[model samples]
Structure formats: structure tokens, C-alpha cells
Target: MASVYHINKGINRPIVFKGFVAQYIAYLAVGLVLLLIGFAALYVSGLSLFIVLPIILGLGAGLLLVVQRLSKRFGQHGLSKYLARRKVPAFLRFSSRRLFTSLSRGGIIQ
Candidate 1:
């Protein structure tokens, strides 16, 4: 009889696609969606292909470059962390002592 074992690694395993991994795949997907939307909008607005094509190409290329940089700078979950971090206040003031002193002075409790 042979014993079989299964190992459960963490959920942080990197996703690989065509030699790219993790955040890079997400970056590409987001860039592709934005590019499609931009080109479709331009086409529907009756813009000539001569103008729309260049604009779309230029914007898509620039956006992909930006995404590549972001993916490189922040690994998997970096974008989420960045968005979450932005919501935090830069300076949090805690004055428990001051609050207690003020409450004591208010005479609410004898």
C-alpha cells in the first residue's frame, strides 16, 4: 500500500501566465480593459481611425508602461495595500488623558 499526502500552501502563491506572474497578470488585464473601453468610446464618437488609432495606441502604450512599473514596484496585493493605505489619516491624535480631564471638569459625575 502506498501512502498519499497533500500539502496546502498559503494562498499567496504566485499566479503564472506566459512567463509573467502575479501582479503582472492583473496589470495586463486592467490595461487591456481600459484600452478597449477607450478605443470603443473613440470609435463610437465618430472619430476617424487615423486620429483614434494613434491616440489609442499612444494611451495604451503609456498605460502599459505605467502598469509595468507599478507591478514591479509593488508585488502581489500591492495595489490593494496602496489603496487601503491612502484611506488612513497621516496623523492620528490620541489624548485619552486630556479627554478624561475635560470630562472630570464637566461635572457630569460627582
Candidate 2:
């Protein structure tokens, strides 16, 4: 049962994301991909808006939650843990900048 803080602190206890700006870029990349994939999946699968809608909305919500958690407060508040428990679609990736950003306020993005 690894916690977000536990994972953020490297095996050697090194702090991740040492800067905030880098993290912002990382988050932006991930968010964009998710949005794109959701739209793509909808067309590819030929699913109705009702079905595709949840996937798009859920993925976006997850991205928003992570950003909100890290930016609103630079501390461990279990947001990452919540995300980790859920399944992020394969189309999206949780990047390193995103990982570090969520862990601390030391992100590259302002």
C-alpha cells in the first residue's frame, strides 16, 4: 500500500519536481492528451454521446482534480491516492512532471 507521499519521496528521499513551471507544462500535456483521446474513442467506438460523455467528462475531471489539489495547497491531502486507486484510460498517461507536481508545489508551471 504505497501512499502518494511515500512514492513522491524517492527511494533516496529526493524531492521531485524541484520547480513549479515544469510541472505546469507536464499537466497541460497530460490534460490535452486525455481530452483528445476521449473524443477519438467516442468516434472509433461509435458509442453514443451518453456513453462517451462519461469517459470524456471523467478523464477531464480527474485531470482537474489533480491540478486543483496540487495548486490549491502544496501538501499531502490524499488527492493522488484517490487518483491512483481509479483506473485512468490507457490513452492517457500520468507523467513525471504531473507526478511531481501533484506531490508538491515545487512545479515549473505558475
Candidate 3:
């Protein structure tokens, strides 16, 4: 028989935000790659500049939003709780979820 394991505990550590800043920069780099790819596709397909511009902008914004969320989820232990105690909005809780997925997919904070 084989044994399997799962992680069910939280870690207690300090988050300096330094690493996350680096993570965000990398995310932005990916965003640029996406933009360039969009542009290349449009050029190859002979599509109007106007048609591809919105699609590129939308992709970039979506990527930016994802990076922001990821930083939050990877914050140091008790960081978010401290923020909530200071009256951080309820919407941020949901934002954290989106960020977690983004960071995981982007291979930044995970």
C-alpha cells in the first residue's frame, strides 16, 4: 500500500512584501508577453488595429488584477486578520480568493 499526505495546517511567519513585489513584477512581465502575443496574432491574421487593441487591454487588466490578489493571499501570518481589524472592506476577502488562483496559476507566490 501507498501512503498519501495532505497539508491542513497554517504557517506562522513574517511577510516582508519584498518577495511579493518581485512576484508582481514577474506577473507584469507575463502580461506584456500576453500583449505581444495578441499583437502578433492580430498582425498575422490581418485584423484591424482597433479590433485587437481592446482584447489586449482586457487581457492585461485581467492579469494585473490577478497579481494584486495573489500578493494578499501570500501575506505573512495574521497580516490579513490585522487588516480586517483595521476595517479593511469585505470585498477584499473575495479578492484574496481570486488572487490565490492567479498566483497559483502564474507560479508566483505558490
Candidate 4:
């Protein structure tokens, strides 16, 4: 009889790509798209490769480093939580009295 082995991956495991987790991949994708657009714009504007390449390479390297750092520092969901934290205060600061009030005496004024 062959031994039975069970493999278990917990729910909500963060997807990883070459050491980058889920949201980091999204950040990198957007960064790369912007980088490509910038490169294309530079090339279209008749900029020499000598000038354009270095700038693109530098920016791309910086972007990768930043994304990697953010991924490491924030684990999987911390970055999003950090981003949402700012908006949360404003969202929670709602007044119920102001929300259901009538602006004018008339029902509808055009």
C-alpha cells in the first residue's frame, strides 16, 4: 500500500511572483505600464537612446526596489490597509442628522 500524503494550502494565501506578493505584483504591473508609456513617448519625441534608456532603466530599477520594499514591509494586505486608513477617517466622520435633512422648504425646486 502506498502512503497517503495530504497537501493543505490555507485560505487567502497571498499569491507570490518571484518574491513579490499579490498587491506588489499589481503595483509592479502599473509601474511597468507607466514606464513603457514614458519610454514610448520619449522615443516618439525623437529622444536619443543614450538619454532615454538610462532614465527609463533608472526609474524602472527604482520602481522595482520600492515595490519589493513595500511588499516586504507590509506583508500581503498591510499596504492596502495603510492606503485605506487615510480615507477611513473621512468616511467614518459622517453625521446622520445631515444625511437625511431637507435642503429647502419645497419638495422640489427647479
Tens-place lDDT per residue, model 4, 1-110, is 99999887766687899999987899899999999999999999999999999999999999999999998999888987888997765544555654435445444452
Ranking by TM-score: 4, 1, 3, 2
lDDT winner between 2 and 3, please give it.
3
- lDDT by residue (6-92, candidate 3, tens digit) is 875544433234455434556667778878987898878998878888888888788777776666665433444666777955463
| Model 1 RMSD in angstroms | 4.9
Q: Candidate 4 regions off by >4 Å?
A: 1-11, 87-110
| Order of candidate numbers by lDDT, starting with the best | 4, 1, 3, 2
The C-alpha local distance difference test score for the whole of candidate 3 amounts to 0.67
Give me the overall lDDT of model 1: 0.80
Error of 4 at 56 (Å): 0.1
What TM-score, over all chains together, does every model reach?
A: 0.61, 0.40, 0.45, 0.68
**lDDT (0 to 1) per candidate:** 0.80, 0.63, 0.67, 0.88
Query: How would you encode candidate 2's per-residue C-alpha lDDT over 1-110 as one tens digit per residue?
Result: 87665444445432334332324446757887979886897768788887877878787888777775674454343445557767666685655667666557756554
TM-score of candidate 1 versus the correct structure, residues matched by position: 0.61
Candidate that scores best on TM-score: 4
RMSD of each: 4.9, 21.6, 18.5, 6.6
Q: How many steric overlaps are in each model, in order?
A: 0, 11, 2, 0
> Least accurate stretch of 10 residues (summed lDDT) in model 3?
10-19
